[model samples]
Target: MTTTTENRHALPTGYQLQDYRLISIIGHGGFGITYLAKDTKLNHEVAIKEYFPNDLAIRENDHNVHPKSHQDKENFAWGLERFLQEGQTLATFQHPNIVRVLRYFEAHNTAYIVMEYEQGQSLSSAIKNKGTATEAFLLEIVSPLLEGLQAVHEAGLLHRDIKPDNIYLRDKDHSPVLLDFGAARYAIGSRSRSVTTIVTPGYTPFEQYQTKGDQGPWTDIYALGAVLYRIISDKIPVEAPKRVNAIKLREEADPLPPATKIGRKHYSERLLRNIDWALEIAEKDRPQTVSQWAEALLPPPSPTEQAKPVKPVNRITPATTSAATTRCGSTTAT
Candidate 1:
């Protein structure tokens, strides 16, 4: 049998990985492959992510993943450990806006994270189908997502990758759920000589491209800011590297146009200003945390708005970041 990229790296349909039966491949990225699978024991669908960095490892005919070379073994094992760590950390949260990790385990010479399968189109698809999003629609999605992300940060972890495609809008309530965390990918890239820095061109900030970049809550803030820019302006912000290069040459202004200028008429001045603040080329200039940026993006509800009866479903509620840390992995529906 000839080996191609997808079939070579991905487990074939009907292949069983423990209790999960692979139905098909849903998505694949540089760090892993996400499969749509059925949990035979539970008799339900789930999304299982397998750690297989094609650059460092290859799938042998025996159906076990092995390092491409002896020199790559240490790096591959290090990344697998990090991948497992990410799943364990994520399994700690019970936030509604975050994707739920049901469990994680190791087999087939790699690791797998089983997450609750959500039915929805990605924010990228919604934007393409609906054109520019309304200020109301943007708030509905961003507010809840920020709370979820804040929880992740307070847990001493970072999502690292936040893009429209990584944000999913559930079909049931149109509520947003964050997906495809980049922590493992980012950690591996930082240490492995074979892998380059993990970045999504327009969404990644200037600092992410640097090996020793000072990343923190501010790093995620920049990526989320870029997501908002894409929604309101219907155009992606200029890539961060190009913007920084223009500054180095003593340019008078950033290569990317300010959100305030593009979204002023449709969105409030406060909203536009916050978007620009999040996308600041200098890390020092951006909002330092999710709460800080969200304050401006999401204002306090008015007396009348608060006085009204709150719907039991899909209403934004206040949550402390610490609360996210207290929960263990048992909250999702079976």
Candidate 2:
């Protein structure tokens, strides 16, 4: 979905689902609807995602979701299983930068994944409010997100979606939290073998356009690079398919301008270059891992600097030292 659209079939407010009581609809997409809910047992708010693929299912007067047609029954069942699996996988993650999944369960002939409700605005909204985010601002958000993404990769999963809209900046500290994972969406699309449901235009890498394309950490790197591109240039990068066509014609014909040329004056060369490197059209050409990409953004150690043995510096205060001295100087003989 280009934007979160209204779902008329969403569970009504105050409706009970296991321990969660629906408070309001958070968002809806092709595959599901997320709701802001209250956990009655815990007496806390949480986000709950309900499986309701619009294409294959419908909600009846009784509020139970069922396959729209007999033909969709198998696909819906398969997708539901994958959705449950997605919830299970997410529940295992404990990273601060990734949304925390509390629990998941089946109800009303469907499934729901309950997650911690975060207080923040989306990166897209943040970008829209503050035009062309500063490099320092973007780094503070991106660095921690990369660590979270790296953790996802290590767990043998891919985000598939990494646009600005999917990133949330916590209101408390403006720290980025990766949200709305596309695992179930991708899994459903794979089961149905539909490519249209997979790509997110400018943020999607060219490999995802193919039916059997090789996807890995680099796929997410491209999307993250595109997000940074939007923040720096105030425009989304050209669609990956279009970029692929341009590259086929000639290197100079590539439509997406290099970040180095776009933001060099305002941002550090290393930062811009790292963005450009991640945005490389070919998977093999981009940095293979988050560490590989982040290291380039750091200033290299000086040539004259040599490795020294580790040392511990004193962190005591003079006032505390004087107080200790006074205490040791004299004592009452009790």
Best model number under lDDT = 1
User: What lDDT would each prediction earn against the true structure?
Assistant: 0.81, 0.78
Please name the candidate that would achieve the greatest TM-score relative to the true structure. Answer: 1
Candidate 1 residue 193 Cα shift, in angstroms, is 4.9
In angstroms, the error of model 1 at 236 is 1.6
Model 1's alpha-carbon lDDT is 0.81
Candidate 2 error regions (>4 Å): 1-6, 249-252, 298-334
Residues 1-334 of candidate 1 have per-residue lDDT tens digits of: 0111454589898998899998888778788998889999999999999998888899888889999887678778888888999999999999899999999999989999999997766777667735556777777778888888988998999998899878877666677899989877876788773224588888999888888889999999999999999888878779999998888877757888899999888998888998899999888998887777776677677787789786443344443232111111211111
Q: Residue 332: error of model 2 in Å?
A: 71
* Weakest ten-residue segment in model 2 by summed lDDT: 325-334
* lDDT score of residue 268 within candidate 1: 88
- lDDT score of model 2? 0.78
For each candidate, what TM-score against the reference?
Answer: 0.89, 0.86
Superposition error at 282 for model 1 (Å): 1.5
